[model samples]
Target: MRPLSRRELGPLTGAAVLALAGCGASEAVPPQSTASAGEGGTTYPLVLRNGDREVRFERAPQRVVSLDQGSTEILLSLGLADRIVGTASWTDPVLDSLAAANEGVPRLADNAPTYEVLLGADPDLVTASFGRHFAEQGGVVTRDRLAETGIASYLSPTDLDDGQSVNGGKKARTTPLTVDSLFQEVRELAQVFDVAQRGEDLVADLQRRAREATEGVDVGGRTVAFWFANLDTPFVAGGKGAASLLATSTGLRNVFADQAEDWPSVSWESVVAADPDVLVLGDLRRDRFPGDRLAAKEEFLRTDPVASVLSAARAQRYVALHGAELNPSIRYVDGLAKLGAWWREHGQDL
Candidate 1:
């Protein structure tokens, strides 16, 4: 829910608004078909309002370039990997989760690929999990520029319109993401590919699993806290977005459940005040944050005079979560499964 930070954007740094993919959403083009003739504007021109701009896709694109792991993962799940010619991401867990789905896809760069490199790929469609992916990496290559070359661009619903906010604006109108919203995105892709059934089946399965995972779950009685990264103050999963949803599913109450935003910067005192039963950490490499590694976070909690006294820390009740799995994507189900198991195993013990 902490919109992938500008720090995570790496090469696209300094351009915050340019890259957030799901801050807002684009209105869909008209209804679609499996294969429509690319003739008159009638069924050919698929006009969609993505975020703020209107994107028109003359026909289903055969070649797509994905900008980040989230977008790339979604395409692979939709069975659209064959259509992706290039992919680049600051972090990539697709290989671990999707496995063979992206076996042959070329990695363009660790960060955003240069405009020249993108053009050389000759992609018919460009998909990005964040808005920065559409912006100029080295040379200017905005969605408008891509359109000039007859290329279509699509932003995942994860990075939809935020309605002209100063920053990440706000979390989805529906705080913490809902399964329905997730299903809606799957459906949108189905429309984009004109492969309606595949999308529906995927959504239905996800819905069933999510429901079952959370069904009869009542964590309202327990206390949970999520630790993302460190600064002068700690950043926490602020009672919203994917983290909150996962906490609910696992029957653990979020200690930061009062904050309305997805992720928030809270004082160490506040964390101590809440006294969470357990602490969930989003683990990453040493290079990703100032104090980035999982061990570093644990060390801080154990050494900090104030933090060391918390009940969870006293018991060393920490659940390590891969940073990528913490996002609102297909891998989320894995978190649901993991968190549920963690509670069943430790909830009573804690």
Candidate 2:
């Protein structure tokens, strides 16, 4: 089957010219409960913390701006689509289940929208999956700046680490990410919206799906390499990121497991040396770089003199996955299911 390109997928927005970046997960810090005694539901002036950063909600946010697709989908899943005034920074199309709900939400930009554009929406709250989106160096606006404007901001707990900058900076994972990290985000967001029950339900559903996907499935530690994008020096998955969670869940070993960065660029020569058993290619629908398209990545592996000789390439062992699935989001379980299914179909033969 031919892989879809960014152009074929249609533009996310007229201004989406840059590629989406990857994020790292941090340890989950339990959100503090400020409810009064005998309170039946979440109370106002709710305090949520991610690492050292915290946002207190006096009331449920009515107008929200989700700065990235991952955060947007989480809100949509929680049945808060009506509250989202605008969204931006997409890597792939919204999940099929969310298409109807997402249809009316305005896409502010393909990548991060300008600070002025984001503020133009008059949002009561803003959320993002990556700290980079709120960082001074790479983000459109700093979280502190948002606070000054009386706008509350929530950065995914998955992106926070203790004593680290809420703005994008080097975050060393004390422990690798797990499904629990994703669950923490859902629960916290649900709490913020005064929808704790919905968050619990969503987490339960994801857990059920994950168990069903890997039930009685084991591949005896087969090695795989996850290639996200960039052809010249491909950004491969590292040990402590979402890819590792997917690999561990499916009983597959990541070839680049030694590297700690979420997505580290490595030489083609190094990839050749690792010679992974399966090449998990990210079928990104973004046109930021040369090999972001699945077809382009596949073609490169087949034609490049150096890459063609790799065992996985020669054997045509490939798994095409959406770029969003490779990141730390609800789609991560989708990636796990795909990998498990692939192994079920081909593991015996290999």
Compute the lDDT of residue 328 as modeled in candidate 1. 62
Best by TM-score: 2
Which ten residues in a row are the worst by lDDT in model 2?
13-22
The whole-model lDDT of each prediction reads 0.66, 0.81
TM-score on alpha carbons, each prediction = 0.77, 0.87
| Model 2 per-residue lDDT tens digits across residues 53-99 | 55666567788999989999999999998999999999899999999
Candidate whose lDDT is highest = 2
Cα lDDT of model 1 by residue, 67-183, tens digit: 767667777887887888998864435637577878889989877788878776767677776565654443226776665455667766654535321113334334355555556
C-alpha RMSD for every candidate:
8.7, 10.2
